[model samples]
Target: MSSFRRHTCVAFTAAVLVIAHSAAPAMADDIPGKIAEASGILNDALDFSQPPVLPTIEAPRKTDIRASIDRGVAFLLADQNANGSWGSATRTKGLNIFAPVPGAHHAFRTATTSLCISALIELESGGLCQDVAAVAESIDKSEAWLTEHLPNLRRATSDAIYNVWGHGYSIQALVRMHGRHQADAAKQEQIVTLIKSQFDMLTRFESVDGGWGYYDFRYGGNQPTSSSISFVNGALLVAMAEARDIGVEPPKRVVDRAIAALRRQQKPDFSYLYGEYLQYQPMRGINRPGGSLGRTQCCNTALRYWGDLSITDNVAKNWLYRLYVRNGWLDIGRKRPIPHESWMQVAGYFYYFGHYYAALSMDQLPAADRAPYQSMLAKLMLDRQEADGSWWDYPLYDYHQPYGTGFALMTLKRCLPD
Candidate 1:
């Protein structure tokens, strides 16, 4: 038997034994029938059939990678709005993600702008950017727009707290800004103040259940009553950790609760639930590995960053392997227009988002261990670059290309050799 089958069978046997052990003595005679039933359920849930083997793709040359990054940077520069930000309410399609007026757009624009700023900063810092002068100018304009507008960002409506994304991503951008202006003590102090204000916004908007969520369907009060979303928590936690690295400590209670909430959603295999609301239906497709292809990387990286010892090297590597092998699960949903309209209910937005976090997870590995995955990740990003030098998965108004390119650029940056 093949190694995949061998492992599956062993897992099946162990599962059956565990089930049989919990059976009552009176039902002992029905053990065989019970085992048959258990086998069926396990097979359906695990899908133990061997996946098709994809050919090994060699890493692209460094020159090729640099060229791609330059193209992506050009896309972001060209796509920037006159106000020095990225993304607007333009380019609406038949179906669009709900963004309630100025507030939602504020959050969307802030988050997208934050991502673009981060990408430019990272590439510039790495010395891979070709247009150094232009990049610096763009970063300055974006920093001005972000610091001015981000402070006013808030929930779009009672039910939509999309600003959480803005707060989380802005913290990340601010950290980069803080680092970039180290020589200018006054500028760094202002960035630090902005970062703390974002922290306050997060605390005010944190879900009553702990962590952050974009929706507060339950109560939508000043204290949001939304369920703690796994990926949202993951993103926020990672950003908070980055802030902490710069001596900006997040609220311990908030961090602890977010971590706890994330842990609650994490399955033994590391696949996370779509949100806390889906906890009851743990077996639902959206909560399974296929549905979770985009989430596990971010979630795992968050836990590891916050000192989750259980997320060892092997665990991180296994998820990375799953991400590469089952990348089609995410790929099939790309540019689908509608959200969660693909197989396994995979949403189009998760595509670049997943790969970005996967790149971050790759960073968790030792220097020597990252090369192969870096090559693999670079191949995936390079394969998907658009003729316009941008990468977009979902059609979210005019935000997709800029945000997607931002994520792709950052992901590709991690793919570069140290």
Candidate 2:
């Protein structure tokens, strides 16, 4: 059997007790103080003299990677919606990728829009874009839409899919924008204030355990375990880290606990479970040898980017090497129907997402370790770039391409050498 198909399946067996931290809970009364406290830690751990930049790691295929980013930027510039929000292609309806989903456009629209904005900022910062003015104009329109909509989104219903993701990407875009526009003192202050407000909004919706979840439970008093997914936390955690890097201090306890919550899910081998509470259930197919691979890259990349060196040193780096070097993420032999029921099969749906995270994770490794996977990842991405300069996980519609392209560009930026 191929290495991918030969993996053993592991399931959640029991609930492991999470060590209690008195300050872990998010209480409004103490959150402001905690936000102040986070500043101390942020100042000590990160350098905020300049905007957050992707690692200056060297890749053998730097030329091709740069080309790919330029193409991606072009596609995003060409694909912006007239209203300035990038909506997922609502036209593609089906039982699989498009199962008549509720709030699909609303959630993905903001999330993807912010995602692309962040991408453009990254490209511009890295000097990959040939036309700064055009990208800036695109960002201005998108930022306008996001700013006008922030109030409603901040108070969006608990069930809204946009809660964590939309807020997470919004924070990313705003933080990057803050850094990009630092030369303008007034605009910088204004952008930073907006960034802080979004972080404050996200903090309110954090799961009881400290992780930001995609769904809010406050409305109907629903349980958090059903919606506080790990990958969503992963995305938000990285965003929080970026916010901290750019000088927007979130509540220390909230960031600390979210990291802790994610830490609690890390297995001995360093693979993270899909949900914290799911750690006690069968996990049906989300476990190892099943669908664990689907969540590995995103979860681990979050930890790695957020400075979890223990995982980076011991697990994520090595695992990514194995996954890409062996093409294990492809899971070549497990092609079967009813993909939703099988973890191995469902991984196919997240192919591009996983690869994107994989690229991010690999980018953090030391040169020696990153060398082997560098060329491999470059080829994987360059070969897949569509002629129009966008990429997608599924071909359901062109909607996914912008986000996919954004992710691809981010990955390629990390692949660039010093």
Predicted structure with the largest TM-score when compared to the true one: 1
Q: lDDT for model 1, on a 0 to 1 scale? A: 0.85
The TM-scores of all predictions, comma-separated, are: 0.87, 0.75
Question: lDDT by residue for model 2 over 144-190, one digit each (tens)?
Answer: 88877755564234454455677788888888888887789988887
Off by over 4 Å in 1: 1-55
Checking candidate 1 for backbone clashes, the offending pairs are none
Clashes of each: 0, 2
- All candidates' lDDT scores? 0.85, 0.63
For candidate 2, report its TM-score: 0.75
Worst 10 residues of 1 by lDDT: 1-10
Query: Which pairs clash in model 2?
Result: 8-289, 58-417
Q: RMSD (Cα, Å) of candidate 1?
A: 10.0
The reply for model 2, stretches above 4 Å from the true place, is 1-60, 96-104, 154-157, 215-219, 222-227, 281-284, 305-309, 326-349, 367-369, 395-398
lDDT per residue as tens, model 1, 102-192: 8899899999999999999999998988999999999999999998998899898998889999999999999999999989999999998
